[model samples]
Target chain A: MKRNKKMIIAFITPALVTFLVMFVYPVIRTVIMSFFKVESLTASTSEWQFAGLDNYIGIWKTPIFRTSMINMGVIWLVGGVIVLSVSLLLAVILTSGVRFKSFFRAAIYLPNVISAVALAIMWIQYVFSKKYGMLTSFFRALGLDNLAKISWLDSDMKFWAMLIAFCFGAVGYYMLIFLSGIEQIPQDLFEAATIDGANKMGQFAHITLPLLKGVFKTNLTFWSINTMMFFVWSKMFSPVETEASTISPVVYMYNIVFGTKGVTQRDAGRGAAIGVTMALFVLIIFFIFNRVLKDDDLEY
Target chain B: MKKKVISAVLCTTMAVAMLAGCGSNGGAKSNSTSKATSAASSAAESTSAKSKSTEPAKAEGGKNLVYWSMWNETEPQAEVIKDAIEEYQTESGNTVTVEWKGRDISTIIQAALDAGETIDLFDEDYQRVGQQYASKCMDLEDMAKAADYETHSVEALPTALRGWAGSLKGIAYQPYTSGIFYNKAMFKEAGIEKEPATWTEFLDACKKLKDAGYAPLVQDDAYVLYSYGFQIARHLGQDGVVDLCKNGGWAESEGALAAAKEIQSLVESGYYSEYAPDAYPNNENEIGYENAAMIVNASWVPSEITNNTKCDIEWGMFNYPTVDGGKDPATVANVGAQAFAIPDNSKNGQAAFDLIMKITTGAFDQKMALDTQSIPADPTNEEWPEMIAGCKDAFNALTNVYDWNMGLNTDADLKTVIQDNLMKLFEGKMTAEEFIAAVDAASK
Candidate 1:
């Protein structure tokens, strides 16, 4: 017993130390920084002025920051619904003894394997381009001039265009998760359901969904975290500058912290406050998911 | 018992491996620090030796100078710099170690400086070097005066540098002016004999171009603020524009509404292309393809368009047309430059300044301008690149230069608001009044 405990301690120590240094310490520092007036990220702690809630209040009052928050919220709620539904549907279809299941799975999961930056560039340059774009060409070919004329990268449509592209890339990863969760359920339950005269839809509704509550909660939590940290797609869509239509909280934080071409004021404190706000958003979602989807009593 | 022994061996190996990884990093860091220390000491010794000797005493092995550059290794400018470095080494008996840090150098330079990195000299945008990293820079006033830098370099550039940095902190290497970069072929095709000098003439030119079945003007979304800001700056000087952006009284500003209305007329008259303010490099590319006649952009646009589209274009430039009753004259234009600065922590400031002078003046300046299709920093090197040759007159006529975006981007919070509404105004989605009202409301 003594030897086993000693071995465990020895094995865990490195990881524990790494986690404390890399993750926990940064988290604590960021939270503390949110309350201070830190102009530069490299500024010494001695130079920090205690601003209390001023940064938080200032960030909220900034119109661009508020726009970013709304944009994030929309991406989270709307993108979550589309991504979850599509991914779950694909997961179900793939697992229903479908033909070419492996090939289909690989095809769908390909995007997740690609770099988000490259994927976003592909979307922006090829798909959303007004001139010589795939969508424009396709719509024009179909004699849909009105649709063809729509500038997909315009301010009004850019956000939705980015969301659709991001969601398209995200579906594959979540589908794989759903696939694993679905595959874990015993075959006997489904056989029993079929034997009890439950149709395919009925079986899915009563057995599959109820059993997958835990997976749904997991996916929701992951989605919440991903959405909170959303940056790359927004950045790619607005490559030269941050647009009001595509700005997210993280991008806003980046602009204020690191400074962009147009916006040169670096406010590390406000950036920290934005970071804290995003963390709280993710935490609140986690809490809500835990309370709403109780998976403890659900048997495998 | 055997499994336990294997597990113990594996764990011990893993621990050793991790320790070795960390130890290697520490060793490398220490090695680099010692090297830097030696380099500094050598430079100091050389400086002392030079002071004592009538003839310059070259170190047995040349003293090292580290330079962090904003250009990529593959860029033509970097190629010119590399060639200049070789020439400098042979001429002055000094070794320059250059790290091509690329465009993100601006974002990371401060951190590197703060960390006490052994950076002797670095180059970035003149405005950025002046505004953001002024304290990190060595005051170059004495060196500049001794070298007669103001006489050698573009007159306005050093003056502009002083305006930003409050003293001579850096010297411009590659100066550029922002104006209307247009397709000269399109101008000839439209029978526009002369480049527009005022707002009415500009509108007449636009009409002729439109009548010739061409889009008169095109702007990329990236440069919408710059284009609009120039118009506003023509009305109210760059300072007034900055004040308006910082403290939002756009509707009440003397010529803010007038500028908006002028831009609105352009929009209404179909001066802008169908996709006027398309995403960056898109609308600019249109000019190369002959889909558009002109774009209000920096002198770099022609090179960018050519590089991206591989299209041959007869490019010409003129200053942004003067607005009627504007505060600033046509002479007041937007000028910017890339500059070299010696770090405050540099042990070899004189050597770095010498290297900067070598790269920026005489033959090297002309070489850089020719190779990179950029303006020559040295006024003595009068051979302008073919594409931007027309910019020389406008550049020379400049009495004052404005900051990037005419200082409208001074306020971080309001930049997005101004940019968004400006885009809307250009797209004809919002009227001039609505645009002013929207910006003013956002300010409050």
Candidate 2:
């Protein structure tokens, strides 16, 4: 037994070392970097200055950072609700004795297969284009001349347009997860619910919904993760210059580190601070999900 | 147990080998040398004897000169320079290896230099040398003097360098500037005789175009700060705006408020196209498609107009118009350029310097101007595209040139505030006072 145990340990050692080198080391290093006044993200250690809480203080003082945080919050909360509700609905409809189940499922999941950049570009150029866009043409077809005249890609409406496009792509992915969860819930539960004189809606609420609590938690976690990484869409939608309406913390961090859009200075410490803040945000959401959504797994 | 030990050893060896294999290629030196030796020997057997007496450096053991061009082959300037490099190699019997890294050359150069890689030569904006890569760049004042670059160009090397890097650090590869490009047919239809010279005339032209049932001005949100900054430059001199940035006294400055008020009036007057907020290239597309009359764009717009669109409309350009009660002269244009810098780690610094000299001086500037359809930095070079000839007059009459507002402002937060509020002002979301106040608060 001792020789077998030693042999097992020997096999696991390489992977353990790799995990430490690849993930754990960088996380710790980033946390350390947040406290310093780093000139460049790629700068050597000696170039870093001990800035303490100054980087955090500086970010909080900037109104754009606050706007970015608020924009992210909206995308997280509002976008989360829309994506989850739509995806759940689609999942229920597809799984509920629907003909062409495979075709519908594949069609819904198609957007997920395309890259985020390509999807965002397609929406910006084809759908949101002011002159002859799909939205404009549709509005005109409906005889809504005023709506057709309104610039969808402009500052006031750009965020919503981007959010809608994002949700369109996001729903397909989450719906697949929900569909799988629905499939696992046995037909026995539905039969039992029907015998108890419950309607289809009642069975969905009492039997289908409760059993999919675990999947909900999983979907919610993934949604939060996606919201935190919200960058490419914001980057693609916004102009060359950063706008308050569309700025995300991740996008702000990118511009800060890169010194883009006329930002002459690069501060890696502040970027790391933003990173730490984002991680904390994800952690808080994770903990809240774990605490509030607790349920025992229903056995067959 | 013996079998297990052998398997473990084999696994570790394979992993280490995989990691070790991801190292440098060193292709620049070897590939360039081999190509040069074969190519040079074939072309220059007879001429090498005569050229060896005049230029000993030309009769060299295959010297590998590496250059990273900031533009890809798609850009006319890059093509012209690449041809020149090929000509230089064949004539001088020296080896040159060039990498067309495009706009992402900064990140590539930074990574290569940080890794202590041989970064012999690279082209980037002049400001980058002083702002970020000063430590890695070699001063080119002696080289510029040797090449007599100042006498040929309209602006001296120090003058051009100061606009970007604040000091002489690199040599100008080519001159590129920004101004307003208008549709001549549209102007003629609006009954506007010529390009506007002052604020009043500009406003009048805009109104005339609107009355003539046309979108007077078309601009993207991306360039809002730049368009507004030119107005600010007119009100406050370049130094005053710089002072505003340093002192955070934007709220106190009448010039800043005046600049905002002007843009607010334009927005209120409905001079901008409905598609003004569209992303870049799209706004230019509007102008190209005759959906709008004019656009404030960079020198590259002329080339982009032909390439990106198929419209057969005649194009004309004018400098940013003068303002009423302005501090600076109307001829003051916003000028910038693409330049080359030699890295301190360069193995062939002299060769790299000579390459730049060869490209920018003599008939090269004229050839570049004609090929690229851009104005020559050398005011002496009379060659220009007929469409851009009027702009050359404005360029020649320039009393001063300031960097674009977006590029000039050093404070990132204030820059963001300026761009956001200006965009809001154009969208009628914020007033002039609110825009200035927001910028002031952010600056503080």
Question: What is each predicted model's overall lDDT from 0 to 1?
Answer: 0.84, 0.77
The candidate scoring highest on lDDT is: 1
lDDT of 1 by residue, B252-293 (tens): 876889999999999999999887778776788888888889
lDDT measured at residue B247 in model 1 versus the true structure, 0 to 100: 74
Off by over 4 Å in 1: A1-14, B1-62, B90-93
- Predictions' DockQ, in order: 0.53, 0.50
- Clashing pairs for model 1 are none
Residue A117's lDDT within candidate 2 is: 88
* DockQ-based CAPRI category assigned to the predicted complex of candidate 2: medium
Candidate 2 has a TM-score of 0.90
Q: Residue B222 in model 2: shift from native, Å?
A: 1.2
Q: How would you encode candidate 1's per-residue C-alpha lDDT over A179-282 as one tens digit per residue?
A: 99999999999999999999999989998899999999989999999999999998888887678989999999988888877455689999999999988888
TM-score on alpha carbons, each prediction: 0.92, 0.90
Question: How does residue A285 of candidate 1 score in lDDT?
Answer: 89
User: Candidate 2 — which residues are off by over 4 angstroms?
Assistant: A1-22, B1-13, B20-34, B39-59, B72-78, B91-100, B151-158, B162-167, B359-372, B377-382, B385-389, B406-408
